[model samples]
Target: MKKILVTGSAGFIGFHLTKALLERGDTVIGYDNINDYYDVNLKYGRLNELGIKKDKVKEHQLASSELYPNFRFVKADLCDREYLNQLFKENKFDYVINLAAQAGVRYSVENPQAYLDANVQGFLNILEACRHYPVKHLVYASSSSVYGSNTQMPFSVHHHTDHPLSLYAATKKSNEMMAHTYSHLFNIATTGIRFFTVYGSWGRPDMALFLFAEAIRKGEKIKVFNHGEMERDFTYVGDIVNGVMAALDKPATSNKEFDTNIPDAGSSNAPYRLYNIGNNQPVKLMDYIEALEKAMGKKAKKEFLPMQPGDVQKTYADVKDLINDFNYHPNTPLEKGIGKFVEWFIAYKDSKLK
Candidate 1:
């Protein structure tokens, strides 16, 4: 079994990916700071479902069990250079997946320093550790927000991503650049995934789907930004996990015949690559709300409002490259995915009440 290190293992994507890796018989060392970016209880609740107790988590502490013999958890901050170095030295992971970051565009506007500390400096520390102790592949999360104000119908990895509308988008784009530099200088196999609007069970509360679901269920008015005209490539979480696993399994190789004169943003002469992992099916915001309403068996109290600062009008992903490279295709329909999410939401709420 390959030993893999997954940062942010308590986060939504990380949690699902870790479960997948564990089920595939891989030895996974999970790391997370478990910061109170949202609800601390919710984070702990996720860990509890995974059989990890609060007391077991400590700075650099490792926990394993016979039931999930290959699974382990470490409570460590990625920004801590010494601790991260120690983790690299001890674990010697075959692959490293960095999914931890300060998420949310509007949140970045209010807490710019948090983004600098976690997304920039923290990512630098991960890259440095990888440089010192080489891993087979490094897969990190990028965002569709990197497309910024582009008028393109579907955002493609080959297209130039020079404009970022928000601090969160800027940090993600910066991560791709940093990864390219590392791949160029150190020959590290790095792949950056520009994820669209991912949603499903165990999703972050800050995300639109989860927030709207909770508010609507509570009989509260749901904010409809941009007068509910926004469009999003609302991808299912399971599909995203498949894309990430595919990228991790296939390490990027340098394009020997890459033309320097007319360079492509998605590929390089170095061991680096980028792809957009989305459903490739953009849905109108109102349509998405309608799906949620069907799942909830109730209509949301709508409060139409102008677009919030740092929010985009629409996002669509061009996943042709992802399909060509990995045969990856997202198959979940909005109605089906929303139905599953609603089921989980009800169960989770009941469990919380108990």
Candidate 2:
């Protein structure tokens, strides 16, 4: 069984991916700061699903799961160099998935340093540890936000991501570049997966779906950005998890067809690759909210507002590369995904609110 280090394992997608790997019999170690960026309880609640008790997890210490012997967790910040090095040295991980990042667009505008600390410095730490410790593959999270203000029909990796609208987008774009540099210098096989709008059960509260659901449930006016004119390639969490695993299993190899004269932004002659993981189905913001309303059996009170700073008009993913290489396809219907999320939201609220 492969030993994998999944950073940000307590975060939404990271939690899901960690559980998936363990279920497949891979030995998995979870690392996270468990930052108060959102409700810390939600992060702990996710750990509950992995058989790790909230009380048992300690910072910089490894906590083992009784149910899953192959699973363990360590509470640590990504920028903690000494701790990261110790963990990597001890584990000798076969795969390293760097998902830890300060995640939010508007939040970044208010506090850009947090993004630099986690997304930039934290990423550098991961790359350094991997360079020294030597992992078989390094898969890090990128975002469709990197497309930033690009009104392209579908944001393809081949298109230029030089124009980022937000600090968050710029950081994600930096991650792709950082990964490429590591692959080039250290011969590290790196795959950067650009996630589209990911949402589902146990999703982040900061995301549109969760915020919309919470506001609707409370009968509060939800701020509809861009006056509900926005759109997103809303991909399901399960699809993203599967896609991540597929990418992790295939280590990047040198691209012989790559030419420096006409460089492809998606790949290089080095052991570096990039793929967009999304449903490739762009849904209007109003349509998405309507789906949630239908699922929740309640109508939303939308306060239409002008586009917020660092917010994009729409995001559509081009997963042609992912499909051609890994045969990955996201088939979760929008309604079905919303139904599951709504169901989870209701149950979660009932359990927590009471």
Candidate 3:
């Protein structure tokens, strides 16, 4: 079994990816800082569900279950360069999938430092460790927010992404560029996935689905930014995990015949690549709210608000290259995905109250 190190394994996407990898009999070393960026209980609750005990949820290490026998957890910050280097040296991981970051777009506008610390500096450390250790493939999370200010329908990797509107987007773009440099210099196979609005069970509480569910349950008015007219390519979490695993399996190779005269932003002569792993189906915010309302059997009190800063009107991913390379396709319907999320949310809320 190949050893894989997954950063932010306690976070929404990371948790799901780790579980998926373990189920497939891969040896996974999961790491997360367990910060209070959202709800710590929720994070621990996910670990508990995965059979990781509460007492072991601290820095430097713990194991989850005897059932897997191949799963380990490390509660550590990515920014700690020394700790990261030590982990790399000890584990000698074959694959590194980095999903850790300061996630929200609006939060970046308020606290840009968090973005720099986690997304920028932390990622730099990861890149350095990967360079030193020589992983087979390095797959890191990029954001669809990097396609900011572009009027292009269905954002494609081939398109120029220089006009990022948010600090969060800037950081993600920077990661792509950094990965390209590393791939060019060291021949490291690096694949960056520009994820759209991902949602499902055990998602972050800060996301729209979780926030809307909580507000509706509490009989509070949900803030409808952009007057509920915004659209998002809401990809299901399962599809994203599948795409990531596929990319990891197929390490990027240098496009030796790549033309420098007409440069392609998505692929280079080096072993670097980027893909847009999204639903390709943009759903309006109002429609998303309606779906939640139907699932919960309750309507949310709406507080219409103007579009916030660092927010975009729409996001649609063009997954042509993802399909061409990995035959990746996202098939989960919105209603079906949201139904599962609502079911879990209700059960989780009820359990918390008891």
Candidate 4:
């Protein structure tokens, strides 16, 4: 089994990805700072699911999972270059997945330095470690928000992502550039996955799905941004993790037919590639809310509000490259996904009450 290092293993997508890897019999080393960006209990709860006792976790120390013998975890920040270097020296990892970053567009506006420290500086440290340790493949998370102010429907990997509206988006775009540089200079096989509105069980509380559910449960009005005109290609976390695995298994190769004269943004002559892993089906905000309402069997109080800054009107992914390269298709229906999330939310909330 391949030995993989998954950064941000305590976060939403990272948690799901690490669980899948462990279940598939791969040896995984999970790393995360477990900061209080959201509820620390939720982060601890995810660790608990991974068979990691929160009390046993200590900074810069490795903890083995009780359930998965092949799984181990370390509570460490990515910016700790010395510890990162030491970790890489100790573990000759076959593959690396960098998912650790300061998430959320609105939060970036309030705390730009957090994005710089985590997404920019932390990612640089990962690149450096990968350069020294030399992993077979390095797959990192890029967001559809990188599309920024592009009015284009179905954002393609080939589209220019120069006009990022938010600091978070800009940082993600910077990661793509950084990865390309490492791939070109060091011949590191790197792939960037641009996720579009990923949601499912154990999702982040800051996301709309969880927020709306909590607000509805508390008899509070759910905030409808852009006056309910927003749309998102709400992909299932299961589908996203599947796509990630598909990419991880296949290291990026130089595009044989690449033309430097007319460069392709999606693929390069170097061992670098980018793909958008999305549902390819955009659901309107109101319709998404309706699905949640149906799942929970509760009507939501609505509060229409102006669109927040650094937020996009809609995001639809053009996953043709992803399909052609990896045969990945996100098939989870909106209603079905919502149903699964609502069930999990209720159980998790009730468990906390006890």
Candidate 5:
């Protein structure tokens, strides 16, 4: 079995990916600080599903799950270098997936330092640890937000991501650069995924779908940002996991056709690669809200609002490279995905009240 280390295993994408890996018979060490970025209870709830008891977990402690014997959990932050080194030394991880970051664009606006500490410094530590302890591949999360201010439709990995509008986007773009540097200097196989607006069951409450569902369920007015003029390439969490696993199976390799004179931003001669894992379907904000309303069997009190700061007008991803390379196809229909999310939200909300 492949021994893997997945940071931010308590987070939405990390949780799903970790669970999927464990189910596939891989031994996984799940690491997360479990910070109160959104809701610690939600994080713990995900761990509970993985058979990890919150009462038994402690900072820097290693806990194994009863349900999945191959799965282990570590309560630690990425910025803690010494502890991270110790973890790497004790358990040599074949695959390292770094998903621990201070997420949210608006949150980064108010708390810029948090982004630097977690996204920048934290990721640096991961690279350092991988440098010290050789891993087969290092896969990290990048965001479509990195394409900020680019009015181009269907943003591709080969597109220029130099015009990031938010600190969060800047940090993600920095991760790709950092990964490329490490790949060149240390020969580490690093793959970065630029995820579009990912949404699904047990997703972050800060996400649009969860917030919209909660507001509609409470009979409260749901704020339509940009006066419902926005569009998003909402991708399901399951398909993203598939793409991630496929990439992990095949480590990054140099592109022989790559020309340094006019180099591509996605891949290079170094063992570094970038791919956009999105649905490639940009749905309008109004249509997304309507889908949720239909699934919940309720009408939302709409409150038209101007676009907030650090927000993009639209995000449509070009997944041609992802499909051609990894054979990864996100087949989840937008309406069907929304229905599944709505179903989970209703049950989850009811359970939380009790």
Candidate 6:
């Protein structure tokens, strides 16, 4: 049983990953600030599912899960370097998965400082801790948004991502660079997974799936950005978690074939690598909505709007590296994924009402 530290353990993907690890007999320390980026109640609800009561969680204090003996949770901010160092020094973790970040592209437009604080400074703290503590593997979350302004059909890790359209994308790109630096200098086996549009049960309210679901429930108009001209590789959260586990099991190694003359963007001579964890199936925005409508038993009233600032037109992830390296393929059908999400959403909403 490996001892792992999962930052952003209260978030959507983080929560699912933590549960999976615990079920697999891994000792996990779930850490999160439980920030009010969205509804705190939803975060608390997720924590509750992990046998961590909302009242039991205190800042920097570890709360043991009642349901899973292998799981423990700590409420803390990623920006707190001193606390992070303390936590790392206390626990000799086998692996560390850094998923905590100030998410959302458009939100970054209004508050760029948040991204810098959490994504930039917060990530530096994780790197420092890993450098000092020396973990077996360090896996962190990157996003498909990094492939900004690149009209490539299937976005590959080899593609040039120097042109980020939004602050969020820029910060995510900076994360990959920062991670590569640590891997090069400290020999930290770091792997960055660029996630596509992940959606499922307990998803972020700010995301399209959740927004559309809520609007449809209220008989309100859901804002269709880019006038429904958008497309996304809508990967399920379950698939993402499985991909992360696969990557974590296989630590990155130096690429002997890496030629400095034409350096590959995906892998380096240093112990650093990048992979895209997406469905590889780009679903149209309108089609995605239709699937959701079928699941919810109600059609959404969409408010067709111009493309918002800091938003990309489309995202399609090329998972060739993921398939070749890990032999893992994310094949969860969009309709099935959306159906599961709707079921969970309705149940969760009803629970909240009671």
Q: Please provide, for model 4 over 31-137, each residue's C-alpha lDDT reduced to its tens digit, 9 standing for 90 to 100.
A: 99999999988988999999999997999999999989999999999999999999999999999999999999999999999999999999999999999999999
RMSD of candidates 1 onward, in order:
1.0, 0.8, 1.0, 0.6, 0.7, 0.6
Against the true structure, candidate 2 has what lDDT?
0.94
Q: Report how far off residue 132 is in candidate 1 (Å).
A: 0.5
Cα lDDT for residue 50, model 2?
95
lDDT of 6 by residue, 210-241 (tens): 99999999999999989999888999999999
Give the CA lDDT, 0 to 100, for residue 60 in model 4.
95
Model 3: weakest 10-residue lDDT segment is 59-68
* Per-residue error (Å), model 2, residue 235: 0.5
TM-score for each candidate, following the candidate numbering: 0.98, 0.99, 0.98, 0.99, 0.99, 0.99
Q: Alpha carbon lDDT of residue 181, candidate 6?
A: 97
Clashes of each: 0, 0, 0, 0, 0, 0
Q: lDDT of model 5 at residue 301?
A: 97
TM-score, cand. 3 vs. native: 0.98
lDDT for each residue of candidate 1 in 1-354, tens digit (9 for 90 to 100): 789999999999998899888889999989899998998777777777677887777777797643477898988888899989998998799999999998999998899999988999999999999999999999999999999989888889989989898999999999999999999999999999999999999999999899899998899999999999999999999999999999999999987778999998999999999999999999999999999999999999999999988888888899998889898898899999999999999898888889
lDDT of each: 0.91, 0.94, 0.93, 0.96, 0.93, 0.96
- Better model by lDDT: candidate 5 vs candidate 6: 6
lDDT of 6: 0.96
List candidate 2 stretches off by more than 4 Å.
none
Query: Clashing residue pairs in candidate 3, if any?
Result: none
